[model samples]
Target chain A: MFLKILYHLFVFLALFGSLMVVVSKKAIYSALFLILTMLTIASLFVLMNAQLAAALQVIVYAGAIMVLFLFVIMLLNLGKQAPLSRRSRPVRWLGLLFGVGIGAQIIAVIYSGFIPPAETTAAASVTIDHVARLILTDYLYPFEMISVLLLVAVIGAVVLARRHLVQGVETVTETAEKAGK
Target chain B: MEYMIPGNLVVAVMIFAIGAIGIMWRRDAITIFMCIELMFNAANLGFITLAQSLGKPEGVAVFLFVITIAAAEAAVGLALFIKIFDDRENIEAEKLDLLKR
Candidate 1:
């Protein structure tokens, strides 16, 4: 009973956090809300008995990816009140209508195909070693490719970020001199 | 647990919906990228949940790949964001009218 209740609670938190992430006006607050969203999703992973995936979700998405976002936002010095251009009323109305139409279609599809739910309980049958074996043997290619991808990304990000540093420095210096005189 | 709790899928769907909306409506490039990540996580959650119900561990393995891809995407994305910001002093996608013609 307690476990079931806990599961529902976590699921509620996950959905609420996701809403917070989307609705927040301040970009930094939105980013922080995403971290909450990721963490709650991690909790959901744990409930589903995906322990390894849960840990990776926190470490990678919440920990690494979000930190990069925060770093860039800070570095760019984005203002909280940055002015945003308003979209035309017709465009906004069209978008809303399209969204509602798609959502209604999805609901209709799901309603038309209902299946009997099976009672599949989480039995602690698989050990860590077993999981490791399946991963290394069956999914080795994907694992290796992902490592290469990360490596390339790291190098690419460095190069791109460096390209701007000189220009940013020049602008700062020019602005400083103007202010001093 | 007899009926599909309906709640299990709700969170994933909500996250995915938010991501789709953000990707469509947001003008900020960085926010769009973050929305993409949110969409990915929503898919990841569904994958793992289905894997667990079916007694499959391979789902977890696939999620690991997702993490890798997400990290790589963020790195390249942030880099591109920096370059764009330097060039235009802004990261709003609508302002980039160079390709409009």
Candidate 2:
């Protein structure tokens, strides 16, 4: 009973944080709010018997990914832009209307009993040990593929962000020659 | 077989809605990316909820993949954003029409 209340509290906090992420004027605050939301979601994962997921959520999503977001926001110095979109009211309203419409439909589906009830037959929790075994055995191929994807992402990011070394060196030497004359 | 609807599923829907709205509303590229992340988290929440109720570990495994993909995406997307900023001195999505012209 108490745990359910705690879970509900976390859900409320997570929802509020997500809303703030949307509504906050500044990008930095949005990132912070997002981190809060992630943490709450992590706790919700814990409450759902997904302990390994909760740990990864905290360590990777909130810790690493949000840090990357913060670094980008800081690096770009994206602050105090005109909050309002230049898009006319109608176009913007379309987005809001569609979002609400789809959300309502999904909620109705959830309540319409389209989904079957839980089995509750085995009742085995998804612990770290179970996850490890599955990843090593059943999910190994996809796991290897994910690592390759990460490697590709690493190379892609580095190539995209780095400047041409030859051009950089030429610019430095050109400046040096100008200074000497 | 008389189980109540899980409240978390509804919450997941609302979060996804908030994300979609934010993506459309926010102009900043980073904020839009954050909204995308919000949507991903909503999916994660739904997966975990169903996994718990259904007594399956596969959902949690899928959650790990989702997180990994989110991280990889953030890294590459931010780098791309940095490249855009370096070239244009601003990251406004609308202003970049070098191609549209």
Prediction 1 global C-alpha lDDT: 0.72
TM-score of chain A of each: 0.74, 0.85
Instruction: Give the winner by DockQ.
Output: 2
Candidate 1, residues A1-181, lDDT tens digits: the string is 7778888787777777766665666667768888988998998777666687788888888998999999988888775733332567677557656655654555455456452343457443334566688878988887788888889989998987786445435543355557769
On residues A70-173, what C-alpha lDDT tens digit does candidate 2 reach at each position? 98888888887727467778878999999999999999999898877876635746677777888889999999999999999999999888766445344333
- The TM-score between candidate 2 and the true structure equals 0.90
lDDT of 1 by residue, B13-87 (tens): 667776776666666777777778888998898667656665667766777788788888899989888877877
Error of 1 at A6 (Å): 2.8
In the range B1-100, model 2's lDDT, one tens digit per residue, is: 1122268888899999999998888777878899999999999998888877876778888988898899889989999888778766777777756545
Please, what is the whole-model Cα lDDT of each candidate in the order they appear?
0.72, 0.84
The TM-scores, one per candidate, come to 0.83, 0.90
DockQ of each: 0.46, 0.57
